[model samples]
Target: MDYSQLRFVVEIVETGSISKAASNLFISQPNLSNQIANLEKILGKNIFYRSNRGVTLTSYGVEVYSYAKALVEQYAMVEKKLMTRSNENKIKIASFGSEVINSQFFEICKRYNENNYEFNLCECGVEAAIQKVNMRDCDVALIIYSDFQQNKLGQLLTAQELELKNLFQGQLKIHVSQKYPLSKKSNITRKDLEGLFHVKKAYLFEGMFSLDYELQFLGIPENQKTILANGNKTYNDALHNLPSFAIEIDWKCNKALPSDLNRIPYENKNLPITCGLVKRKNEFLKEELSFFVEKLIDAYG
Candidate 1:
């Protein structure tokens, strides 16, 4: 039935007379009476007992008034919830490193948002980031190049199942702790590192695994090389205790080294490394994720 009629019934009961209710509603009393008559017809029950004493509601009218008022309130509440959720979907983004993002990326997302889009941001490691895509937990995954490309590293991307999109590539160099007696050398030859205690930074999961495999190509025996702790804590401590090198993009290569920690070229010419971004083969890509990747490519390409 018409919700307006429900309101009319409620107003008439409050004002104690159709004439008073019509004045409050700014509607003609005749029009108000017709609406009440229509509502009673739809409900198949008489709602009011009419007389010079104004109107009193029957039992059925009381029940409908309670339910109708509740229904109108709930309907308004549902509309509000839907509006909030719609606003949130404008943009959704998940990325690995802070350095990975650039201005072009932000500009793209900003434009989308200006055009009325919602966004969600998730910061995670390369491997975990990709899982967000596979599980559909996120619309797009911004992952590290090494983690995205190397299957044995952690979770392997199915080239056929998901599109592998490239973003940018950069070089990671071998560094040394300055405290080491040999730290003074701007460049260390492969022979100079043959017997020194050595460490390398790697991820806790697939990054370490792939680094282990790649080291074999460097002729470093498994027993000779140490996988430094995954994150910054382990990276700093390992550098303090032993001769280790961190391999990261060139930008990160310029940070101030520990007083004794020296940045040096790898003694070996054949240090195997490559870093970039990736996405699923055929999945519908997220606009923000795409924008972020494009920015990375434009900056580092």
Candidate 2:
């Protein structure tokens, strides 16, 4: 009946499991179960058929689920509107690529501090960043994709009703510690990385793995040793301290290179990468968002 219950219903339907939904919603399983049971009793109908595998919506449940999803979305819109009204000058931006984490990006952000506008910057994976923009959870998102993923990514953006603006383009480079044996090389081939471990940035969304272009481009098999890092700092630390390497765009690598780390160009075709900003399609770019985008272009492009 309320927004919280509607949210619970929507999440449960999406996840297909009360336990998983409860975990995601940050509530106890028993509490969620009791609430759902109360809702079902009030309606005099079962919303879902519980099973060992998971819960499935009943015929009546499908109708309720549809309304619940719409209500939840409406509630979100109302909440966002209220928040924006109260914090008129606040800007929410998200970035999935390493370029936005460097000193240059921070310097640009500092320039905006003088204007007294509030800024919320977040670092996330490519898919998450796009999702935030699609949902209007953030004003803008900066993400990176390989050249080969251009058409697919464009199609995905179109499907989400989002628009992309290209910001920078560069070649991919392998980041490794200076102590690494291959650091002396100006460029390296795919065969050179055959047995070495690869460090990759981890995505928050489970089972969403298509964004890892570097690994796929190299034809790295599933059996290969791989290390997952949660953020740019962790990924860079792994490159410096562990016997592993990470593939990153050249502009970002050059801007944030550690003294002990070295970036060697990949001597392979299809090593090009493009970084861009994503926003809702047909949405007018606010002055702050436009200014930030210009700063990013000046810094990286």
Candidate 3:
């Protein structure tokens, strides 16, 4: 309800504990708890599920924390003093890997005064990631592609003088809400997803993008419904709030609410999905960039 309450939500989620957030905020635990309780009262919904171990976001809490974190960061951007820009510490990386990589990048970036350096971490598809690296806009990128697209991907990399370092492989999976009957299964077939709507993200590659491109490319049929989600929040909200399901490769790393979710490898498509790093063939990463690469390699392991 208030600016401080938004700060409280962001801090708690970051620390993963109320008492920790209170300590970081220089306030008593009871005062922190009461402030959050008051905010929940104003919003008319519980923002967290508490236990002795700690707290996790309720479905509504996910939405609140997202907005709260964004608002808090936005508030920090309201500055009256103007400063000149410097390109001295620019660190740019694009990823199609996992949200975990984002966390790692930020954790390392925290070691610096942000005003003294600049960084850009982008979440993007394979082609875009390759293009960024090829154009030298980014020193490197973490990306993924279906083995089905490997040859074409290889040719593109060759033409662009890009190289790939394979890190890990995973089967693309279908994640459904726990209430769905498919959730009980160890694997899901195309027939099982016949009637329920499928959630997917639309990515732009070379100024061309499509909503059903992925399914069509994989030779899968979209008989029921297909929703075009543009970001994490929309994609997640559809799964938690509806009987919809998502077909994705990174079941291991999405920062979604575990709001009764289940994942089963999609038996319908046994595509070998590869997550890897992309960089210019002759590129030698600088010190900070090399640190990021090491962090990503450790994270993928």
Q: Highest TM-score: which candidate?
A: 2
Residue 243 lDDT (model 2) = 74
Stretches of candidate 2 exceeding 4 Å from the true structure = 1-86, 99-105, 114-116, 204-223, 252-259, 268-270
Q: Rate the local accuracy (lDDT) of all candidates.
A: 0.60, 0.75, 0.75
Off by over 4 Å in 3: 1-84, 112-115, 179-181, 204-220, 250-260
Per residue, candidate 3 scores C-alpha lDDT tens digits across 225-279 of 8776777778778887777788766434433433466667766566556777888
Q: Tens digits of per-residue lDDT for model 2 on 134-197?
A: 8877888888777666787888898999999988887767777888888898877777777777
For each candidate in turn, give its C-alpha RMSD to the true structure in angstroms: 12.6, 9.5, 18.1
Per-model tally of clashing residue pairs: 16, 0, 0
lDDT measured at residue 106 in model 1 versus the true structure, 0 to 100: 63
Worst 10 residues of 2 by lDDT: 204-213
Q: Which digits, one per residue and each the tens of the lDDT, describe model 1 over residues 1-301? A: 7778887887887788999999999999999999999989987999998888888888987887788778767867887987764654555555644333634446666767664465566666666666776776666655545433366433466632444555544443455666666667766666666655555444423533344444444444344465655555566677767655544443333323234455555543444244444455655556666666555555554
| Residue ranges of candidate 1 with Cα displaced over 4 Å | 1-87, 90-98, 102-127, 142-156, 177-184, 190-209, 221-228, 233-243, 249-263, 281-284
lDDT-based ranking: 2, 3, 1
Q: Is candidate 1 or candidate 2 better by TM-score?
A: 2
Order of candidate numbers by TM-score, starting with the best: 2, 3, 1
